[model samples]
Target: MVEQQQSDDNQKNSEPGVKNSIKKLKNKFVPGFQYTLIIATGFNISMLVIGCLNVHKCPVNKNIPLFLIATGAIGIISKFTTYVRTRFSKHIQVVYFETSLYSVESIFFFLGSYWVYKYYKPSYDPTDGDVYCNKTAYLLAFIYLTFLYSLLLVMIFGCCCAFCCLLCLGSGEDTSKAGCKYSLLVAAICNFAMLVIGCLNVHKCPVNEKIPLYLIATGAIGLVSKFVSYFRRRISAHVQVVFFETSLYSVEAAFFFLGTFWVYKEYKPSFDPDEKDYCNETAYMFAFVHLTIYYCFIVFVAFVCCCIVCVAICVSATADTGVKYTLIIAAALNISVLVVGCLNVHKCPVNKNIPLFLIAVGGIGLMSKFISYIRERLSELVTVAHLESSLYSAEVVFCFLGSYWVFKEYQPSYDPFDETKYCNKTAYLFAFSYLIIHYTIALAVLLACCCFTLCCMICTYKVRTCCQDMVSVEQENDTGIQYTLITAAIFNFAMLVVGSLNVHKCPVNKNIPLFLIAIGAIGLVSKFVSYIRDRLSKHVRVSYIESALYSVETIFFFLGTYWVYKEFKPSYNPLDRTKYCNKTAYLFAFIYLTVHYTILIAMIFGCCCFVCCAMWMAKAENSRSYDVESQPTNTEAREALTTNDESEAKP
Candidate 1:
């Protein structure tokens, strides 16, 4: 009798339409999650139908209503998948298939809802001349759809987290397996947040429809899959997830690159001969293009790394291996992007400093990835996580510093059509402050990482020094720690200088270069002298050569800045313009500025590469010892560092 009762219970559990405890409660209060979505979908479809029927009376294009219709259809399909999954939960294969379908549907629905809400929602002001405008009803529908859409995203992500937790509870404690789940959660949260914020402030946000709609569609679709993961948590379970994430990341990066390049390709290289004022230079268009491209790039990258926990979810490879591969792929994509960017940079609208800043960003990623590859091969001692965090921190610092300066220099007029108002102080200040604060926080985080890395390196070194065999290794590793410490100190010092100089005008133009020159000369001479002494002592050190190159590059950058300032004389006064320069001279100055900054940027980037590599390689070698076969010989390291330095010194 007990066996028969057990069989009956099992049969009941396996049957379709059976409710679990969670579902029972959910159904009683919420009218079924899937059913609610179906109802919401029906409401949206009704609204879209109304809009379409009155398209002739509406002032807007008919395409707007059609878009709403498509999105409504997507919502219906997504809800259908949800219903299937809920009803047939006992069928594992069906569950998996439905989950994938639901995820895709959710993506489409999210995008379609976002578009309709962003672009199609009518402004209900009664003063408007449009006769078909239903101000109150339309606003109410907009609010309802926006809420429903956001709730759908949040609920789906929440369900994934809940499911993951249940799985962990059912099995054993394994933290690594939970990473991709968290990544998805974070991505979904970000999307939801943006949706809320955008909807709340819909009237305030500006829309730029200049970017190719097709590319935008591709990017948006690719990015939506960022948070979705395979249900299986086996060794190979997350491989498909990684493939999709990385592939999408690459595609988004490609689109941004292409968009930036397209603008450059179309931009006229030379100023129009009939132009009246230098302030009205068409190059201002470059700033607008860059600004647009920047926002898109930032949005996509955010989708990829909303919080940047950087946890490895791919179980098939080592933790660092997965991360290294992701970064390597990203680097390759960035390189291709830079190649296109460089080819068109001459004509692209942007301040000379912006490209330089971009180069530094790209170079930082490439060097970090290369360091990871080398360390992995050599089996280095320091924890990959710690080192990566520190490196990322440094990259953030450099990025912010560059960003602040670029914004400071490239303030374009907001009103291109109005000739009288030549400057947009409000816009300039807004952009400058925003970029500055954004990077400042990033820099602070990086500085914290550097401090953490320092402590880790010291403690690890001390622990290893207790063993006699590790004494030499410790000494060698200390060089890298030293480099890191000095770099951090110098970075702090530079920031202080920037802060002080920015406060006072005379000090910045006069004192900053002199300060840099002094610092560079001292470091350059000391490193060169140390290199000579080390050679005489029958010891060869790559750090000295690397340091010397950085110093030289520093001097070159500062000197170039000064030279350009002195040579590129501009006349604000129309009366005595000939005394200072002609209109053609102004054009020449612009060209010179671009070329000059480009070379300086390249030199600085190269210097940073060699120094950072030298430091990372040095530390990584000491972090862990490897078999002599895979270990990089000191001679080889020196050769590689020197080769890079030499290349940097060239034009």
Candidate 2:
């Protein structure tokens, strides 16, 4: 019996040991972790070699590479320690080596890389600017350094995030929120610093425009993602967040490191450097185009990935049907524009009508979506209340001046001295389109729809009032106003496009009206779809619409302003004096130029209004949360408290 018991006990102990061995084996091969280990080892060995070489060359420069070697060695050791703990230890204790050491090592490596590349001349001739360094060797070295530093950044970010998660795990909701908020604050600081440094040194040796752009894009994306993550943490962050971030950093590291070597090969360095500007201009243009296109791609992919993860994981925070459908419509619209762009393949604005049309539509959509969202949330917003009034005032002024200018200049027949009827007719047609469209169609629709909708809503509210239930009569009114404003804005935007195109008399420009009409028709369909979705779905999110608008606004506003001020220079045009100087037509040109400046001013105000509205909305959300939490069961008491608080604050 004793012998049997001893054998049974031994078997029981061996079972757990076998399982533990299997677990350790499984942990050793975590896909990214093992790769990280290999990279770390390679980095440390290379740094040591580089340090020894530099020490042999110059005694003073020895310390620089030595510091880098020391820091990098520490990083490799820390990474190994991390692996050992993860694979073998039952209780994994968080250590400073894995977190702070990575940052310290990254800084040292970054400085060392810059110093070596900037000073070391592999092969160069004083007579002609030429570097005869083994191109492949330099390229490989650059790639290895960039990969190491980028890995360090990813490691730091992961460690910070994981630490926060661990601290917040099993804590109360408030504590978790605080931890995430603090994490975000730290991330923002680090990213902003990186951006500033990259910008200041972007034009120097070993630094380029791509570096600054990467930092700026990364910072923007991280801030937005972290904000969303803080509010809702249902997504498997380890899989989604880390994967996207790793992809982004990896692309940056590989592209930029290789790009630097390509630049070196293309623009050979001189041993005896001169103060002559001999940059390859094509390189700048190529960089500009690449960054512009790729930045948008990166941001959009990141946002959509996060949205998918959030929607899939967070049951309570589901995406609105309207948002999904809007994305589909936007994708179709963008694809159509891309097709047009590919077909045209020209330099002139008139030839690029489709892309310009896309821009105009995006701007209009953003403005309309923003108006609708704000109207729904805050009916008493000062900006919304005054938007129509300001627009009408501007319209009345434009109408009187425009009519006077046209009538004064117009002649019945072809009289060159007096403005020809044809030219006069086109001018009047373009100039007064807003007033005519607004007075005839928009005004009628606004009045009839507003009155009918209000009547229906009032009746619905009366029935709900009798039943002692909350009625959305006010919300219905907001929706009504939203539709009206969107229609009006689209009309104005279409007219602007038509008027602008008319200024250029190319035959291709004639097709612009047809394009505008088609886009407007598509807009109507989209609005209809949105309406139906809003009616059936509980919520509508227009963030994509907002993003599109921002792009349009920034591009058109800045570019148009610069074009008018520099390229067109209506004030200094010789043609304005010779071609249309017969009957005080210059006055009309002046008026038109004034309108451009006015539009610029309006864009500025729109930006300000957007910022203010965002702040107000955030405040309102927080206050509502507080109210709900404090007054969960007391309806009348909550109402009284809200009334008192509002009165006190307002008065």
Query: Could you tell me the lDDT of residue 107 within candidate 1?
Result: 38
Write the residue-wise lDDT of candidate 1 on 128-158 in tens digits: 6553345433454456556864665586667
Across residues 339-362, which tens digit of lDDT does each residue of candidate 2 receive?
A: 443343232222222222232223
TM-score of each: 0.30, 0.29
Q: Model 2 off-target regions past 4 Å?
A: 1-200, 206-483, 503-543, 550-574, 577-651
Q: Each candidate's lDDT (Cα)?
A: 0.45, 0.43
Residue 196 in model 2: lDDT: 52
How good is model 1 by TM-score? 0.30
CA lDDT for candidate 2:
0.43
* Residue-level lDDT for 518 in candidate 1: 32
